[model samples]
Target: MGVEGGLKCVKILLFLFNFIFWLCGLALIIVGILVQVSLHNTFMINDAAASGVPIVIIAVGVVIFFIAFFGCCGAWKENYCMITMFAILLSLIIIVEIGAAIAGYFFRNKLSAIVHDSLTEMITNYKNTTAEFRDSVDNLQKRLKCCGMNSSADWKGFASDGNTVPDSCCLNVSSNCGKGAMTDPTKIHQEGCRNALETLLKNNILWVIVAALVIASLQVMGIVFACMLMRGIRSGYEVM
Candidate 1:
């Protein structure tokens, strides 16, 4: 009788566990689906390009949720059919997680290396261009000093010359020149770089969506397994 009671307790615990697992699975699935939809409609691939790791993590969570749900259901039902099904599902989830983890780890490093390389190249190009511009500006400053400020007599020639003048000199030469000459070239480059980086990162949205879907599937399977397990356990108890 004691042994029977112990078994009954175990069965009850198993049923509860299975139910909990099912709920967890369902929640995960819903979350995953929402994430996927958001990515599809709102996020671009570049948004994910900067951090593929998070997407992979979400995917793994989904798979695990499903596995837990199925396992719970199998245990609760005491149905060999469910057990076998759950085992297969769990095994697949485990395998996929392992593969994704490995791939994600390597992919992250590769992306980092690529971004670093691209940044280095961009910086180098920017520096070279900036240096050239600085040299031109310096030369123009020297020319301005040598030529002296243009009066009305020299205004036409000064305006017609293709020489690039500094803002200070431009103001001295013409009020209109100074008004528009204050544009910062460096700021322009910085803005362009920022936009490019953002676009690049948005490229990983598809992968993230895929991961969310997998998690949702897992959650549903978990819930089904849990209910089956509970029914089986109750039946067993009644028979005993």
Candidate 2:
């Protein structure tokens, strides 16, 4: 194809890619918002340390949203300046994504232990804590269909005479399920919160890795096409 025709094709391709990238950015923003909202509903808004994850997600989403806009405008206007900025931003995002994936992989096993310890600590102080705090753990167990951190046995230390587990941990939800679980193993959920939560984290991390790979692939394409279009524009103009 001629230089002009090639440049046109590159511009079209980059524009389409950027459009999709922009959508992904929007999705990220929505996810981040939802996470924060959920945290608020769970009454964890005051926990500054735990709030960092959602805040970071929101920040990344905003950054990506701008970068995608830059890519689109650069392609449309054939502007080298915007193209360079877009490429630079994309490279930074790719680096961050790769680093996060690597960190997640390396810490995969440790994450479960951390979660286990956290849950255990929460359970230990369940009665002494606020209603919101207790409710959060109950909701988590109910959502995961799990019992204590490791097993129903984990609750033995915390359980007073009749209540071996929380009502949320019961196989069949009921007011007296906690007492039932203490007497009959069948009354309680067999799975533990730690394992269930670990599996969930693993799955989510895998999806993140896959998504990063996909986005990185697209960013690499955008970089290459941007460079190609720059060359074509320069060549065509030089001949004029």
Candidate 3:
């Protein structure tokens, strides 16, 4: 009787774990979509590889959503086959997540160079870019209190005067404050935009890493519960 009661407890816990897991999967899907949109629309980061991270997260979430559903069904019905399949699928999901985490880590390390190059390209084509993009550039400078990609000197081609920078780089942002003030640290922000932008991207990547780790840990517990219930059912025990 004690053994039967223990199996019943495991069955209940497994069902409850899977229900929570389903909700976690749904949350990941929503978060992944939001992050992807923000990276493209808000930050204007058009890196193909950077954009692919969120899509992978979405795919994993979708698989997890269905897998958790199967797990719940298996636990409730005390079906050994379904439980076995759940364990297998959940293990695969964990493997995929580990791969993603590794890719994300390497991507984070290279993010600085990526942002530096992209911002340099934007700065070189400042006059040629669309008005909206120019506005984004100006806003980014003002918000980050930065000048150009690496320094105010990067705008030498854009600013006909070698000493001039955009008013967006001004400390007070008054009209003409940036005129002939590229080297005036008191009047303009002399630092580059690259580091600030790179930091922003790295922070976002940190969030993804943390979320993946938390979800992976929870899935591990769910797997243990699933295996325990599977054992009970296979041993001719009624976990229900």
Candidate 4:
């Protein structure tokens, strides 16, 4: 094929790649919002804190969207300046993402310990905490079918209204079973919230790593296309 035809093909491929890249960014933004909403009312007793994670994710998504826009424009116009800019930005993003993925790998291993500590703290402060916080913990227990941070023994230390455990810790959702179940270990949840939360965070981190790698691969392709298209544009200029 001629140079013009090859250039056309490259531009089309670049446009399609950027369009999909932009969609990935949009998906990331939605995921970030959902995560933030899910964890909004929940309390975190960790020293590192969990509050900023969703915000950072949202910001990364926004930045990706803008970078993809630059890529799309560069390909469409076959502009050397825009393509060079896009390539530079994409390279920087890939480097940052690699670092993030590495950090996530180590973070995943430590998540269980951190969550264990956080849950223990939450259990300690449960009664003194607000109703919303209390409800959040209750919901977690109910959904995970677990009790306290480690065992029902964790609730033994809590003395409030003569109840050993919350209603959510019962075998059934019956209010009558709640107090009585505390005495009968068989009637209460056998597992603990710490284990449940740890499992959940591990799964989340895996998905996050997978997603980052996928996006990074796409970004690499974009960088290649941007450079090739820039070269083609310069060649065409010389031919003219």
Please give each candidate's TM-score. Answer: 0.38, 0.84, 0.86, 0.89
Candidate 1, residues 1-103: lDDT per residue as tens digits? 6545655555455556546555654554554455444333322223343344455455556665665566655565565566556656655654665565455
Query: Which candidate's lDDT is highest?
Result: 3
- In what order do the candidates fall by lDDT, top score first? 3, 4, 2, 1
RMSD of each: 14.6, 3.5, 2.4, 2.6
lDDT of 3: 0.85
Ranking by TM-score: 4, 3, 2, 1
Note the Cα lDDT for every prediction shown: 0.43, 0.70, 0.85, 0.74
Task: Give a tens-digit lDDT track for model 4, residues 1-240.
Answer: 477777788888888999988998887677666655544445343445343455556666788899899889878877789889888987987886666567667777777777777788778788898887788888888878888887776787666544478777887867656674566666888567887777776676666566667888988988887777888888764211
Worst 10 residues of 4 by lDDT: 43-52
Q: In candidate 2, what are the lDDT values of residues 1-240, reduced to their tens digit?
A: 565666788889888888888887777667656655654454232434334545555666678888999899888888877887787888888777566456546555565555656776777887898888889888878888888777776677655574577788887888967873654667888677777776765565455445555666777887887777777766664211
- Which of the two, 1 or 3, has more TM-score? 3
Looking at model 3, residue 34 earns an lDDT score of 77
Q: Residue-wise lDDT of candidate 3 within 1-240, one digit each (tens)?
A: 889999999999999999998998997788778767656655566788887777888898899999999999999988899999999999999888777777778889988877877788678777898887777788888888999988888888766678888899999998888899889899989899888988887877777766677889999999999988888888898665
Candidate whose TM-score is highest: 4
Kindly report which residue stretches of model 1 are placed more than 4 angstroms away from their true locations once superposed: 26-43, 46-76, 113-240
Which parts of model 4 are misplaced by more than 4 Å? 35-46, 49-55, 160-163, 183-186, 237-240
